[model samples]
Target: MNRYQVATAELASSQKSGAGVPAYLRWVNRGLGRRAAAVAYVAGLSPNAVTLISGMLSVGGMVVLVFLPMSALSAVAAMVLFLAGYALDSADGQLARLTNRGSIAGEWLDHVVDSLRLPLVHLAIALCLWRAGLPDWSVVVALLFLVLSSSWFFAQTLAGKLSAKAADDGSAAEGTPDWVSFAKIPYDVGTLYVVVAALAYPPLFLVLYTGLFVVTAAVAAASLRRKYRALLAEQRDYAPEN
Candidate 1:
């Protein structure tokens, strides 16, 4: 087999469980990431390098959104950059696993970038809306989105770590229905980027963005409660007997 083919095979074998992953991530972003990771592998690039590249691309998209005039072309450009960065975001971890160079530091860097970028994207949207002379409530919606998105990210990450620590098998309960992934489309970053691409049309963007925020907030509320309760149960189960 050719080197690229060999790299692809290796990455395919090392993929993490897809349970509960959104369809955009499972079906779209990860597929693009696998291709990018294979290319990175062939070029002998490190995972950290790939991660930095992803960050740069995302930042570039935000810059375009905040600085460039709102236009269909500009929206498309920013959307493309954001989507590419997200795909690369997935690529870095796959590359790390493929190269066996995964480290705590690398994972920390990835999460840090993600945590910052998620909020910043919404902030950029708010700025763009303010510049466009949209109503104050639209700007308010954007800021609220920033808050909700970051909070969800923090809670989800914390719950995963806590769950792993509390469980003996290092596994959360299984039997997540396959349809849950489809239901999570509204929560996907890819979906957000697609909504952000509607920036050219203020009315459309506001309607869609607000709708996404509502759906996300509802999902986050229910999911957070479930996670908190699950963690509490796990903690009680593992407590030392008197």
Candidate 2:
């Protein structure tokens, strides 16, 4: 097999479970990322280098969103940049796994970039909405979205780490429904970036953004509670008898 084909096979073998993954990431982003990862492998780029490139692309998109005057062209530019960056974000991990070069530091850097970028992206959207002379309520929605997205990111990450530690067997649970992925479109970061393209039309953007925020907020709340309770139960199970 050619080098690219070899890299593709390696990536396919190293992939994480698709359980609970959003449809866009599982289907679109991962496919794009696999190709990108194969290219990066052939180019001899390190995983960390791919990550830094992703960060730069994401920041460029945010800069355009916040700094450029709102217009159809700028909105499309931001969306393309953000989506490309997001695809590369997936590629970094795949590249790491393919090369067996995944490190604690690499994972930490990836999460740090994601944690910071998510909130800042929402903030940039808020700034744009305020500058665009949209209703005050619309700006408030953006700010609230920033808060919710950050909280959800933290909670979800912590819960995953804790649950893995608490599990008696390291193996992951199975049987996730296929529809769950589609149902999580509102919670997908890629979906959020796709929505950014609508920013050129404030009324349309507001309607879509607000709807996403509501669904994500509701889902986050329930998921947080479930995680907390599960952790508590695990703790009790592991507790020594009195």
- Which candidate achieves the best TM-score against the true structure? 2
The 0-to-1 C-alpha lDDT of every candidate, in the order given, reads 0.87, 0.88
Looking at candidate 1, the ten consecutive residues that score lowest on lDDT are: 165-174
Give me the runs in candidate 2 sitting further than 4 Å from their true place.
165-173, 237-242
Model 1 C-alpha lDDT per residue in residues 1-242, reported as the tens digit of each score:
98899998988887776666788898899989999999999999999999999989999999998999999988988899999999999999999888889999999999999999889999988999998889999999999999999998898787767675422222212566668778889879999998877988879989999999999999878877777777877775665659
Per-model tally of clashing residue pairs: 0, 0
Candidate 1: Cα lDDT at 31: 85
Residue pairs whose backbone atoms clash in candidate 2: none
Residue pairs with backbone overlap in model 1: none
RMSD of each candidate relative to the true structure: 3.2, 3.3
Please provide, for model 2 over 21-127, each residue's C-alpha lDDT reduced to its tens digit, 9 standing for 90 to 100: 78899889998899899999999999999998998999999899889999999999999999999999999999998889999999999999999888988998999
Model 2 error, position 27 (Å):
0.6
